[model samples]
Target: MNPDKTLAMVPADTLVVLDFETTGLSPNMGDRAIEIGAVKLERGQVIDRFSQLMNPGFRVSRFIEDYTGISNAMLAEAPSCAEVMSQFAQFIDGCNLVAHNASFDKRFLDAELDYIGSGYSGEFVCSLLVARRLYPEAPSHKLGELVAYKNLTHDGVFHRALADSEMTAQLWLAMLADTQKPQLSFAQIHKLSKTPKAKVPLYLSTL
Candidate 1:
């Protein structure tokens, strides 16, 4: 998984949507990612998504197996993190990331890249923050719950990166429509990336 190999597959400046299924939470606590998915968006549309299962170089926990339905046997034949992350980073070059919980995905991704001798300081937008602000009336902000509430059944295979990324992209588009503000500018979103100084009023949703 060389840089040149990745560049040859995807072009620059594409909007890369990302998702991950991990062995556990907190990269700082030794949790490693087991799957990665990235979707390229160009011209405000999804062009393609890259996804692969990864061997996290550790045993899968019983909790992880119960939650994601991915076990050690499933990852025995999967690629390594460096291998899949290389391809993911290639597709994501020069593109802003969109994800449900941006920090969780970004932290692990950054850790993996850093571990592989790559540095990352990319821009990102979080749909979870957006949901907390825009859909205050909804009780749950989790992606799966949102999918069910929105009735957007599209054969999503959870614990797989690509499928989750695709679903997140669709959910974001739907949210834009719901808010009647489809043309939000880059500057506006950049502001969203900032940590708000004061606690703002958030709406309460009925779950």
Candidate 2:
């Protein structure tokens, strides 16, 4: 139950890069997710993908609209997080989840899973952490900034679920190269997440 193992290191196979666009910042404050995107990797290759827009049962902010390009009208036709999380949980089953700022996405996801009478406690790898550990000399650690620093391009427009997920995937590949560690298996990661911690750092997502 060593907290250091949460993401201390990993092997390079069966990773799932995930991203979420939520109605607002605080999941506990009623900010629910409106979109989700995920890409599954096996042995350094992307083998499966998942993307869906969700109805958060609320309105998206003007700022959010401008940022993510996901409108209320677009969400009206989408499924609820409860509906999609079920499938998403399955999609990411037995894989380590990777995200740029993971805590943000994880909090919203954990709350949604709770609401659905389920639990989503899994091992997660933070790209921001990798950035901190590997590129401590970098001026910025924001995903877009990191992408630019790495000289990578976002194939799809930014902010959308699938596009963001794809960017996360590429970012993960770059991180793998930077960290020089193989991807970890689900068993190894889950044990790390479940272990108790004395002082959990303010996760990258919150920053």
- TM-score on alpha carbons, each prediction: 0.81, 0.80
lDDT of 2 by residue, 1-207 (tens): 553354234454557888898888998787899999988887678888899999988888998988889888999999887899888877876556788788888787788888887764447766676566556667898887788888888764788877877887787677656543344444433433333332223221121
Whole-model lDDT per candidate: 0.72, 0.72
TM for candidate 2 is 0.80
Candidate 2 stretches greater than 4 Å from native: 1-10, 181-207
Backbone clashes in model 1: 3
